[model samples]
Target: MGVRGLQGFVGSTCPHICTVVNFRELAEHHRSKYPGCTPTVVVDAMCCLRYWYTPESWVCGGQWREYFSALRDFVDSFASVGIKLVFFFDGMVEQGKRNEWVKRRLKNNREISRIFHYIRSHREQPGRNMFFIPSGLAIFTRFALKTLGQETLCSLKEADYEVASYGLQYNCLGILGEDTDYLIYDTCPYFSISELCLESLETIMLCREKLCESLGLCVADLPLLACLLGNDIIPEGMFESFRFKCLSSYTSVKENFDKKGNIILAVSDHISKVLHLHQGEKKLEEMLPLGPNRALFYKGVASYLLPGQSSPWFFQKPKGLIMLDKQVISMSSDPESKQGVPICTEPESKQEVPTCAHPEIKQQLPVETDSDFNLEVPMYAHPKIKEDKPMDMDSEIKQQVTLVSDPEILKVARMHHIQAESYLVYSIVSSGEIECSNTLEDELDQALPSQAFVYRPVRQRVYTLLLGSCRDDISASLAVKEWFVYPGNPLRHPDLVRPLPMIIPGGTPSLKSLWLNQEPAVQARRLDALLACFNLSSSRDELLAVESPLRALCCLLIYLFVQVDTLCLEDLHAFVAQALCLQGRSTAQLVDLQLEYISPRAVQLGSLLVRGLTTLALVNSACGFPWKTSEFMPWNVFDGKLFHLKYLQSEKGYSVEALLEQNRSWLTRFHNLKAVVCKACMKENRRIVGRGHWSSHHTGRWGRQGSSSHRTSSSCGHSGQGQPWRDQGPGSRTHEHDQWRRY
Candidate 1:
């Protein structure tokens, strides 16, 4: 996190330190400074994700197509002005920051609770003001960037560190992001992504030199000043005693920063007096409140420090990972040890930050014994160790085969189309942990199970299948710790999962086996495994016969049908309509329609589909990405507005033909998918009924056409005089869901 209250502190300084200017104008100014040089800015992808999608961002999972379309517009604007942006994202959790991570996650969870509460209390969906970032956005965004052919990197260390380092090393114009930490770094000027006025291409930027000048300190003093005010490594409340003294020592500043500004100014003044004096340990304790480790202050400040020169890895891309002479940082289980410094040491010119990837990262993999998701690691997958690079290279290198798994895994992942998820799959494979980001949805609405939670069974199976490799040696880093999302009280820990093995038709194969073999027989077996996951093992031939364009779509629908505990004809039929809408001009039409209100049911269903899409992406990753990456585009396949509209039409009793009346061409493909979905469910439900797991009374609910009476009484809670199929079997509706909003 950035210095606490620094945004306010900088805002108080106004035009001197921070000012709003057209982004193009700023780029032009930089170009003038460099004469003949192109203006390139290193963008913080995390910050962009938070600020970019405004005014209906994650209201119903996401409007991926539109979101991406808008993202392209922003990028095109940058290009239109001759500004090149290189985006960076974070990966691999830092030990010291877990608490901060948990705190932020819980805070987002509170917003989730509030959004649904507002809906339950008001009987209408909340307005555009509620902000929450959903999961898979980063992966999705990376995909979007790839389509645009933008250069991007997901650091094995931290994105912020890499971003600042890249900017300073390359002598870029500045770093653009909202993170307060950018202010603490003495590298390039920092611009606020939040202050971006997309229409005019204007954004607010902070002049660090001016900020330091106004505060009466040197640029070198910024990090210490930020620490004194509190940061991620240092809590703001940790300086209560110092804060009290600062408040008493100075009167309120004449600036507009208010009380926080007064304290900041006071701290700066105090720093000026003791700047040289606190070089000694005794003087430091006398001047500041610090923990036992004064070195932590150094480390926190050092986290912002950039290497004297850029790493060789950035330039070694296609040439492959060359061994660096410097020792790579160890990912120790003891995080404190990694952050520990015996004494504060300042870096001189030519010093380099420790790289994070290590040789032992490939030493071995450990999987849960008797794992619930029955998957065995593929030991037979042969990979060649590079003859060009040294025997030891960073696991991050694209082709350097480690003692870990197949080189093919990395080769496939490095493809331009799928590189966005490169870190996600790599982290899971290398570290056995997945650092989940914020996924916005109506968790508070009990009408549906938490979408994330609902998918755990799927994920657990995925983890086992992906991480199921057998390695003789296992390390602490290999222990499974997945960042999870669910209802109250867990407080952001990676919730434990007890996965069960899924029985594939021709027996499960190693992840390596999934990718290496491409025989018709092998491909058929892989397809059968995918079908078996959705309870459609018997209909393999039918799925195989589907047109390739509709194959992924059919798999998604069938997956949704299998995953959801219960289903209905209306919901299932609407799913086809939504999928059909993607293949036509409907998304463009949706862009023109103003959808002010969407019922909770539509949001839930749409959110579930989006979640399903991401899960399938994860599945594809686990199975070595047999499907094309383009098949996963949320924008092409999913539009939240379009989904909600179709849902409302279905709720109002519109037939499939009527729902597609605007584009009747969809009717043919629509029924084809409908027949496939109904057949898939019918086969699966027969098995459920045979096992006595589902009641015979509701067997018609998933029948070929789903009799009109069955449609009237299905699990989507279209209330009628009949019991409906539920996960717990035929049951009465739990509660009346307000399907329509109050006008």
Candidate 2:
């Protein structure tokens, strides 16, 4: 291997002391963990590892390679756990590392020799497995990794990490020259190449714990921690300002690489406000260095990742179906500049136009004459408008015309001109009750009316405006009710200014509307502000916009956590026995909120109760809960302290088999709907995972397919899995030995 560009640097060398020391340390540690277990570790790289790791000049490069080869053989002596030395060329990764790498030098070589040397023979090295994963070097590393069988890697990673954990689980000793940000999955454990030790497993564990503690996280949280710190662990929390500074500092733009290595979006020119660079002009070509600017490039990426403050808050309230408030009127003729703000000032206060006394506020203020105009506009110019009168300033201006020549005096005159103009008013309304003109007198007074309103002959019409809409859009309405407010978004008329996610009909109601009713979404938002709250958006008027099953599941999960009450008996059982199981072990811990106070013994008893109840529900057709059974009932049920499932069946003739069939049908349908989504995803891309529908890319596609699968699956499937129920014995014996323990 020859050193080309920056690869001639020290890092490109074959095996430096630290690299040897680190790998040696890790090898020894693995030996201790599995006394006789010697795992043959492979060096997987997209290119020749020696080319990237070894320097151009070495005191004993051949000897070091021999040492690594020997280490592989020694590890394989007991049990050969083969590792693939796979190399992938990612263009983005390459581009990111361009400045750091030495230039490549092409050399003409015999085709047969090159092919045999680089591929067939070398890939099948003795005692060590090597795989050259086909990939473009210019693409992102994530793309290369994805192509390398994510599902297989995910499974293996999970297993390896679990085996290394302290108790029943395994942990991993992460080793990679690449950035730690690559680990986003919950199970992946990350350690620097230096962290892995060769002595005992304790070194690995200690390193893992120390890293976790330094990051203010648990051992399990390393993946998330890595995502935030970015590469090579620069001082924490520096990523924020780094992006801003980068964008401001540099003006060069790089070409965009797609998932494949093709250049999808070309960088026509670099545009920057700081340097005053413009599009379609190579202004920065002369100013910027020809090579990659690492600091500047990284900062630009950080800026893109950093979202504006308003975007998060804009979606805080899922105002179902955005309706404009007609009450707010802007005096500015420009519609683009005109915006609606919350009505904070009294209507009467806006009647009198105020003059600005302060020069700074006057100069910055929009041309709104009214004092209350500041409430609607984003910028406020006048500070002392209450004390200053435009007419008085004008009168003095006429008396002392010579003062007009002064710049400060001229600015005051400009303020007076603005004060003379009329300002627009934006009015907002709260809830006002309205009655349907066709509603029957008898049905009008009832709290929960099931039937539509019927028109009465010779009856006076009754109706009221609930919440006023913005003048621009009259079709949308914000109606406040005793419990909740409904904002209707007519799909035909999308609020141009604010884009909202369509509410899935039968999905959870809009969070803002729920706020009026104290719904779980609102409760959860209060508990965790980062939680997605509902907002008014397009596609509001559909009679049935059924949310996809996965969306429904998320909705329910959010509801369960947000709701003050513990999960309902049936839901809790289904969540634990089925939902948690589907989520794998990592997320199962998320539902362990209730485990802390209760004893492990008590928990096992409760889990049994939950399991039995879930099993009973699965098997019974009567839809009767197991807690309803007298034998397994908790003593507190008699005292009315614990939860009790409310019975649905009235007749004694109700069959347990029937209830189980019904409940299981519901669960089966839910699963089947999920399956439909999974199948739909596979249809588009055969390689896509069954769980891909849950991914951000496929969420919209799955949602649009809608309720049909759920309805059909719900009605059609028989409760096959739910039918085989063996009672796990009565509660007292099981309650004595609790199993579910809290963290």
Q: Please give, for residues 576-684, the per-residue lDDT of candidate 2 as tens digits.
A: 2333122222222322212111121111122223222212211111111111222211111110001111112201222333323346545554454334333432332
Error of 2 at 134 (Å): 20
Which candidate gets the maximum TM-score versus the true structure?
Answer: 1
Error of 1 at 677 (Å): 1.6
- Number of the top-ranking candidate, with lDDT as the measure: 1
Give the lowest summed-lDDT range of ten residues in model 2.
453-462
Q: Write the per-residue lDDT of candidate 1 for residues 475-575, one digit (tens) a residue.
A: 22234466655554354346433333566765777766776776666665666555544445677776766766567767777766654434556776666
Q: Once model 1 is optimally superposed onto the true structure by TM-score, how far is the C-alpha of residue 174 displaced, in angstroms? A: 1.5
Off by over 4 Å in 2: 1-195, 198-577, 580-743
